[model samples]
Target: MEELFNLTYKDEVEILKDEDDFEALGDEKYLNHPDMEARLYWAFCRPNGSCEAQIKDIDPLVSIMAFNHSKLNALKRFTLLHKEVIENPNLRVKIKNRTRMLFRSLVDDDFKELNKVLDIVPVFLEVAVDQLKNGRKWNDIFADEIEATIFMQKAEKFIDDSFKEALFFKLKDLRELDQEELKEHLEEIIEKKEKIHTLILKHYKNEVDKWIEKSNLHLLQKMTIKKLAEKLI
Candidate 1:
């Protein structure tokens, strides 16, 4: 179903005031042109461009472009960072058991063309990490936001690290579950990040108790042990 939607979206070439016969032509053109090139063609030539297409419920790329600009930029930056990470022989094999899509692809010595997946990573991460650094809510991060610029409507793990892992397999033309192992590795990374934030939010009763037993929350005197633990967990 999603594939069909993407195909339908790819068909909106030079949006017409009701074109007569060009549906066939556009279909042929799309079929012949590479998927990425065809999508780019629609963006540059369409009326009101990607903006108008989206307004009329046409283009979908605007979702990733219209609002989540930071994520897109981050992915491009990540490519550079990733290139550095891969060049280091010491770091190359470390994430072999990891799950994050981009990281897994970077480590894979045989994988080709890193650019295709770079654009999607940061866009997906924008929401997940938006709350991480800001200490502010979505209303603040996305305040005065333009809907046409955003791709997803709500925040969830669906667009998280696992998707990128799957994409690596697809892009590499290697059919199998090499990425499943990555999940355990990424979970370890997330767990570490959570430990630091636990101090702030004080979630997890047992973990907080363990930290408290170890004098971890001694500085947070104002917070009741239970209240503090809830945030850390």
Candidate 2:
């Protein structure tokens, strides 16, 4: 097993080195390379000859290699070519599994780095629902007020005097909540506390729409509007 692992690692390294050489020779040479053609085919072509894998088990280095060797047109092509892979149920499951494993491995010092990539709105909603149901305050569940505010802006529809007072008291205590545990709690909230759903959806729709417009997120705008309309049912 050790020898096999080493061999696989060496192969990966060679592929990366070859990719660098191909890239330096200009786009024409890179595009004409037999190895590039083979790698693209293997990465994209479906096992059953039906559809390509949008998300492959290939290393990130290989993906970066492809990116460096090609232009935006190539990147766009690669992205579109793998759409089916990304949409595949098995691939999504694998992605989720890997993501959970990675999240679990994060240390205390890694939280800042993790937060940069995480879309905290959903996480905040999960936590907020838990706090509201348990009659807890935001400060009781979060360590940072700025983080709490960001969460509130994304998830909360109304911040009344009572809620503010409760949050203020909790802030003094400085407690922390697990995001995943909060998600599980939110499932219960969805079933037993339907009113919160309306509030959450309302908040999500209002804030996300404004954000999409400001950011010029045309695709997200269309999707969010469609979802908002569907929520009426």
Candidate 3:
């Protein structure tokens, strides 16, 4: 985590390198391609680039960094993207896609760590709702249709994992209570669980059109609550 705090933009390329053969862990290999900066620029700037082209160009490095390095490193990248968007609000759509890549690469444990470090869901929701209310089109929410779909899928997984983790911890706590305490807390426990379920269901993407119109904007914000610190700034 300390290392993440000290990471400057100048070192981003080095950190993204496939040093130590970390990319060979999975079935697919992520070769450390050269001219990474140029690829990144094109990925984010090309007006007519294919969604596959944009994601494929950088996902290998983002994946290795998120899964192999540390969750904090992912947060760092996400925050940096947020800063980029802040500096150039026009890049919001493009940068959002890249940040969601980091979000998708993270596991349940990484999400937990992110929540601990920074609760970013509310901030994202606020921004989303504000933008929609200001007339930002649904199609403009992400870089493209494919990215929107992928991001929503990852959001659903995050919601499911969060609900299960909450339930497990709640049950564990209940087990430690005395019989009398358990009896007294039964209603409270049920209420808490129901609340979690309700929150999860609220973002369950019943329909994209319906979700976008929902005033609360509690959409995919829950997926990377930790990494969204600068996302909407």
Report, for every candidate in turn, its global Cα lDDT versus the true structure. Answer: 0.33, 0.35, 0.34
**Candidate 1 lDDT, 1-233, residue by residue in tens:** 23444445434443432577554545444423455556445434443323322212222332222212222322343332333233454543442222143333332322122223334444324323332222222121111111101212222344445533332222212122123332332233245543222221222234335544544334554155435334334
- In candidate 3, where is summed lDDT lowest over 10 consecutive residues? 136-145
Q: Write the residue-wise lDDT of candidate 2 on 59-114 in tens digits.
A: 33223333333323222423432333344545334334333333332211212323
Clashes per model (N, Cα, C within 3 A): 17, 2, 1
| Local distance difference test, candidate 2 | 0.35
Please say which candidate is ahead in lDDT: 1 or 3. Answer: 3
How do all the candidates rank in terms of lDDT, highest first?
A: 2, 3, 1
Predicted candidate 3 versus true structure: per-residue lDDT over 1-233, tens digit per residue: 24733654335324544445422321121223354543443333222322332343344433222322233344554443323343454544444543444433332231343332234332343232222223222221112222222333334534345433432322223224443453344333334443333332222222223323443435464233212211211
Per-model C-alpha RMSD: 18.8, 18.2, 19.1
Q: What's the TM-score of every candidate structure? A: 0.22, 0.25, 0.25
Provide the lDDT at 63 for model 1.
Answer: 22
Can you give the lDDT of residue 45 in candidate 3? 27
Error of 2 at 51 (Å): 23
Count residue pairs with overlapping backbones in model 2. Answer: 2
Residue 207, candidate 2: C-alpha displacement in angstroms: 33
Candidate 1: residue 159 lDDT (0-100): 42
